[model samples]
Target chain A: MTSLPALPTPKKLGLVIDLDVCVGCHACVVNCKEWNTGGYGAALSDQDPYGADVSGAWLNRIHTFEVVPQGGEIVGEAGEARIVHFPKSCLHCEDAPCVTVCPTGASYKRADDGIVLVDEDMCIGCGLCAWACPYGAREMDLAAGVMKKCTLCIDRIYNETIAEIDRQPACVRTCPANARHFGDLADPSSAVSIMVAERGGMDLMPEQGTRPVNKYLPPRARKPLASSTPLPKEDTTGATGFFAWLDDMLDRI
Target chain B: MHPAPSIIIFTTLSGLGYGLAVVLGLGLLDPATLATKIAHVLAIAMIGAGLMSSTLHLGNPQRAWRALSQWRSSWLSREGVMSIVTFVPLLWSAWVCVIESRYLALPGLAGSVLSLATVFCTAMIYTSLKSVQAWHTPLTPACYLLFAAAGGLVVASLFAFAGGGNASLLAVLAAVALMAAWIAKTAWRRNMLTLVPISTPETATGLGAIGKVRLFERPHVMENYLTHEMGFKIARKHAAKLWGIAVVLGGAVPVVALLVLAIVGQVSSAIAAMFACVALLSHIIGMLTERWLFFAEARHAVMNYYNG
Candidate 1:
């Protein structure tokens, strides 16, 4: 049951995140938790809520990083010190190692939309799926004794009752910076696919060879600022004469 | 990886059990003898205990039966199915040797092949993980197989001594197997030390063009499931000490003990049996420590996000 599908789905639905404008805001993280808790996977429980070391299962997390220049510091003018706000979630990879490592057949990818999901009823919570995933996407739900993950908001995406535009993932819908975009990456004409083409969106850890469906658009280079003119030099040798002249000029004024 | 005691015990004890079962199935030891009967019973006990211990680590043990249905792809599932399948021939072999007082070549051979296959399946559970570079190697299974064979030989030697058979041959076999296991393990550890991580913080975030990346802040103030399960870190100093312990107890002690038994076994069978028992006990302890280190040292790919 853990075996991958023989033929991949024609439509590969995924996300394209732009790193150029992400403000490290936790709105997506908060919204994902809010929606998933009551959505398909309910009660994403928190343990010791008010304790000194509070912890819980979260499907999405945002990490901030300072990307320092590799080669030494820039000499004269300061080199750009880039800080990226990366939102980490399941890429829903085409060859997801997580799906194949599941012993209970709980983890699976949908053939229709290429969405990865877990059947909570069959999950034994062995945590092997989490171990198989290089992205750290899967989180074990201790309270329910099952695995919980992004699900890409499967319930919302497929629901007919919700407005068509709002039927995307909660994270993408609630992102204030508009950094997250969802569409069919397989379709070259799709906005997400076009953005990937234009911005040269990249895969995370391509060496892992998971063939991730999601892509990330790297931050654009910063524009150089125009230089300002130099200030006039002071006449230190004729300080007394200059003061006297300045006083006379002021009196005349 | 947290190196849960349940898993450690499961792998070590079950490996030893299966190894013993394989040796018994090979007809290397006389199945008609009382010594072989005692060994068979012990092997079954070890396997039973190990299988029982494996469930302790599961979040929901009641649903473990569901794990067997996914043998098509999952090594864990395959291991479960194989373990159950192996038990049939293994139990039949044991019954034939102990109750029927006979050694049926066919059943014994089937059990032997299945037992080793089960061990391979167990090792594959770790070997198949692409995220853990330390465990994803051909040497992983090789080491597991060698260690199990070595442990089985030691048990067989003890049984041979107890049943008034020639224990020297089994001791020599145990010694050779132990040496091979240790060598493979050393190679595996060497490979792990030099492994250039495939995923980095840069690659993980797809921001390598920016520059050298470092985590500015964590997403949450408190730990999460990922951090708890995958963020396990061991200090270099502690790991070095544990490695020494694993080598000495699991590898060196058994090798030397078996050699001593082989040489002195011809002199006094009583003394040889005592040393064989010593080797068995020490090897179990060593194997447990080794298994613990296996989980403790492995770096999961997800750790790249946590700056691990």
Candidate 2:
């Protein structure tokens, strides 16, 4: 059934991304593609590998933007323009349009974990599910002939054989900056939930009504340094002798 | 959004075919006539050909039948079911016209409603998509139904003229429908032009509190699937020229030809038939152009993130 099932105690297992430290390294994007391709659905296909058009079915991507600060006139040319690295993936929305719009019953949101997945066997590759997504999370695999998306590393997340510390999503586990967080957002007491509350994590495109489970913590407000210029030309070489002597006396004591 | 030829062909041909089915099912032209029988066959053939063309772009066309099982929530699935269901009555009506040489009211009326329903389902497939805000409107379905009706009337009148029947009334109706479809479509174009973008780069990235978000760099150096498929951009000036051409060819030429045929139809059957042919062909070419723009110009909300 394409209609979402009503589940009691459905755990919204999702990610909380911290934008402050994301550095736009694209490690998460690469790790996600590497893990998801070899694991769930079919291998994510690439159209061209070494050629000019090297497009592929990547599950995650990083987009860089220059913000002109709320009321600023200049765009990216301004000195104070803030740069943000946005890592995007499927948010595993509660009301996932991609799941409901599938002509085949291939796309479904898991009632047990709130993870959206595509059953490759039934996918017609009609590309309607990709179109329905407001976040551009889904991609049509050229070779596999199936829709590929972020499975939230379902195969790794629930695996028992792997060590507990390594059981998280490859993107989160492999993140060098600790930008990505994976936990049950449904539980208020979970670390991810508390972080979201404290840091004021927000949904990307909240107006779209996808009700995305994953939240993005906004970049910390940046302030200019108090003194960027040289202080009073500092009386040549070591002119403040009294303060220097006081520092030496304290060191001796 | 790629303006793919396969889809443009599918939507255009299916609309015209189903539109033809609409009038034929109502017994507009006599069922006993050879021309009417040919028209019936043409209608079914176009619908079949159109449905076939739609599967050309699918990666897993062999698994296309799986699409029929999920009509409960999917408009695309409903369209699949309706297209097949419509064939039953259409084939029956066509068989009766060819063999028995008469129109069956039960199947005829039922086929008409089903054909219209099929068009509605097809339109809803695009209209239901909230991701493409331009298409997420009642106007999508309204334009589809009007165009289908217009195309059907225009074709049905051609058969009416060929058969040497009372075609004047049919010609006038076809002309009016053609005019109305274009008028509604003009309004649709205006709506797209003056749209208040629901999602912007600022809102998409949740950076509105900070500043105007401008794309500094895309994730990939080359175009990815999202960029390739949804990044189709037509300049404003180019789009305006095409819109004017579409209106002139699809609306002005066909409507004028059809109106002229309504007057001189009975007096000069040969000349009227030529005029009807002009109306039919021009209307089709015009609709093809309009349908191409329908896909090309409409921006998807997901593109807000890409800012392409």
Candidate 3:
């Protein structure tokens, strides 16, 4: 059997989010916390629970937004609105400012995969990288005195021990809504790439020009305002006569 | 943006070093004197010490040597490399100045130019970080260079007054520099006062649609490290008070003091030295407060969630 190569071309690992199918559930968020807490590399720790204090570690979260009618190509009916649940995480920006701000080389974009990783050994907990990030993606592991963020399950995604199909990020695998897709964005033939081309997928804050790798496919147009099913004719005669007779008898009794 | 104590010390010390070098270099062009040699030595020592102090701010000082590797994209790396590159010439100039050799004087002049270039590069490091709005402007580098010269002039004035080496000219230069510093400081304050924070709730969330968004349910309850570091903010009222003190004690008072001494013809060595110390202390405190405000006042786009 041939041995797997030690290193590969820079893998542009990223997410492709489908807004059409997401049900606004927090399953991905909970699953991420569980998997990451017990994962091989880094752990997210929560400080307090209950008793006027509740906080838990999460790598991702689902945010619900009601996009009301606004001045744009997209618009709602006079009394209609659509609710979208956005799952937020690090974009793994092409022009990563966080890496540059790190006085120590602890925060670095890997040359092999372009994944931004922190060398925990060198991180001094200065938190300058956090300031440099426009997106509040990276969080400090207060207990560990190091920075932590969505690693895209670097260990799991490439593990040979796990089955090929199962070797994806926990969040992507557990997304019941099938809203999240993970793949190499550099490949023009990837499923995510095809979906993006078909559906007009766009990045958030394109103006900032972080060149975010993640793509959010806008909600596709509603299916031509489907015709309503006709209601049955009113059951007037028999029901009306019977009700009137029963009421009269009861009053007499 | 907080201008940590280590950084403040580093910049101030190195600035003085470069400033003194400028004046001493000018002196060399005129004539070779023992006084110029002493000044040259002093400048080298100051620059060396300041550079050493800067290393303390680094998380991994040992990896400092590796900073030269990424000069392709980073101004910071360029600064690190330039600082080292200039040092060799500086040492050479010091040697020539000490030995009083006309043969090496030309090289000494070249070293002085190199030193100024390195100082300008260092200033640009701060000027380049676009995120730090306060330090991002062209005025930033200009102010740094000018302030360094102003500090050097004050020191030189003290020396001139003590040694009776044309105290009048030095005092006049000090007075003029102090006034210019005062004007620059006022402009800096004005710019900061009007500056707005970049981060907003809509921006942080990457939603083009904007109205308002608050942290209805915070991702975490207890203060995380992000809150401790990037979430720092000072009340508007307190910042104003600090600014007032910074402007008065840091800017106005120094100019007035220097002018008063010069007008009275009491620009003696002791008085000039005292004024320099006073001005230095004022500027230091002002810069500290200004830097604090720089960080504190900046509203990170992340903060929009909290504020909204």
Candidate 4:
């Protein structure tokens, strides 16, 4: 009897980012650039480097924010303080508009698992898919003249030759803070699933409803402020003693 | 929002074709004159050119035929099918109007409805893309229909006035369409200005945390495809000037010019026809600017990555 073809293993690789622990150091960004550049996997290309200006292509980056307290109890006394760091990358959305809008079948989600990817050979430089996307996750590789984005490191994660421990994506592997988790989300018992369950993870721009597969766990709340004595307001009155007396004498004179 | 020149010509030029064809089919004028036949032919040609121009936007032109199969969901497909349907009746009616003028009047009337339907379908194509909040409203399609009729009416009036076919009626119709066009323009502007982009940075990241998040630094400094495509923006002042131009040239000028000519009653038909052409051009310019701005003003959720 003819040997039956081995049943295809269903593997869905995804990333779970922990906002509470993400120090926004961008170590993951650096590591991603390094791994993606040299690997047989998705290669990220960069333009000008070490000339008048230096810029390298990176699959991910962190953003910092300072929201001015607007009519809230958390309002700081004028000039007190603020800052929030946000890391940006593709959510690998399930209902990816980028994929559907592609004229060629170049951009497609794997049916066995929901990882959205761009087939480099098929994609033309046409940027229709980029326009269709609300999340702005897809980026075009200028050198190749085709669309590019975070692949979740498809090559590294699936290589049978590599050790199981080394199979995770470069970004996830290099996260010094352990802020990023990589795993099969379909398995409820997975660490990423437990983290998502314990902390309520949400989809970005749920109103647009692209149904992004990646989950971002909200930052944990800080402890309540301890009571502290308020500082007195500054007196606009002039300096004491000689200046004060001189001003008084001048007024009298 | 990239104003592909081909698409701009397609939409604007085609608007004139379908608009004029409608009036010819309506039997508003005497069948004896050859002007109706000429007008309908020109309109049909413009429609064909517009359809042809749209294909240039597709990456693989060979797959363009598959676009017709997507009418179940895609508005672009609906527009394609309807535009083709618009010609079937138009060609039939035009041939009959020339060869059997009196007998063909009924066929022309049937063609008029199809022309109007084609215009509505074209409008729906833009109105359906929910991501484009500016074009998502019901007013977009309504505006398209009105403008198409307005353009057609103006052309028909020209032919009628030249032939002495009740110049007063032509002027009055032009005036009414101009006024309706103005109202529609205002409504479209109101909807675009008032609607807010529903996407937020927090929501985009899928982080439900209640804290402000901003782009401190991008993943890369060099321009990426997402940045280049989504970062399309126009200044507020330029938008104001364009809106002003659209309102004045597209809206006010036509109404005032047509009204004055109608009331004067001296060479009223010719003046109304002139105003119709002028109004159509003005409306097209205004609509083009508005459409461009609509794309430029849209804030893609991805730009949140760059903190744009």
CA shift at B240, candidate 3, in angstroms?
A: 3.1
DockQ of each: 0.76, 0.76, 0.18, 0.19
| Best-fitting candidate, scored by lDDT | 2
Q: Which ten residues in a row are the worst by lDDT in model 3 chain B?
A: B207-216
- How do the candidates score on chain B by TM-score? 0.97, 0.98, 0.79, 0.87
Off by over 4 Å in 3: A1-11, A18-86, A99-113, A119-128, A140-149, A218-253, B1-5, B12-64, B86-123, B132-135, B162-168, B178-200, B203-206, B209-215, B304-308
Lowest-lDDT window of 10 residues in candidate 3 chain A?
A: A1-10
Q: What is the TM-score of each candidate against the true structure?
A: 0.93, 0.95, 0.75, 0.75
- Per residue, candidate 2 scores C-alpha lDDT tens digits across B1-308 of 78989999999999999999999899888888888999999999999999999999998999999999999999999999999999999999999999998899989999999999999999999999988988988999999999999999999888888882458888899989988998899888889889998889988999898988988888888888887788899998998898888898888998888888787658666677777998889988899999999999989877887776
Query: Model 1, range B1-308, lDDT digits (tens) per residue?
Result: 88888999999999999999988888777877888898889889999999999998787889999999999899999999999999998899899989987888887899889989999999999999989988999999999999989888888888887763568888888889999999999999999999999888888887777678888788888778888888888998999999999899998998898887777656666667777788889888889989988999999988888888
Show the lowest summed lDDT stretch of 10 residues, model 4 chain B: B206-215
Span of 10 residues, lowest total lDDT, candidate 1 chain B: B264-273
Q: What is the C-alpha lDDT of each candidate?
A: 0.87, 0.89, 0.64, 0.67
Clashing pairs in 3: B199-B301, B200-B301
lDDT of 3 by residue, B14-64 (tens): 776777666555442222544455666777888888888877755456656
Docking class of 4: incorrect
Instruction: For residues A1-253, write the lDDT of model 4, one tens digit per residue.
Output: 0111123225455788887788878998888778777764336766665565544445677766544333323235443123455666777776676665554556667766667777766665456566666766666665666667787888888878988887888889888889899887767888887888899876777776676677878776543344345687865376699888877788798
- Predicted candidate 2: interface RMSD? 0.9
User: What is every candidate's alpha-carbon RMSD to the true fold?
Assistant: 3.6, 3.9, 6.5, 9.2
Return whichever of 3 and 4 wins on lDDT. Answer: 4
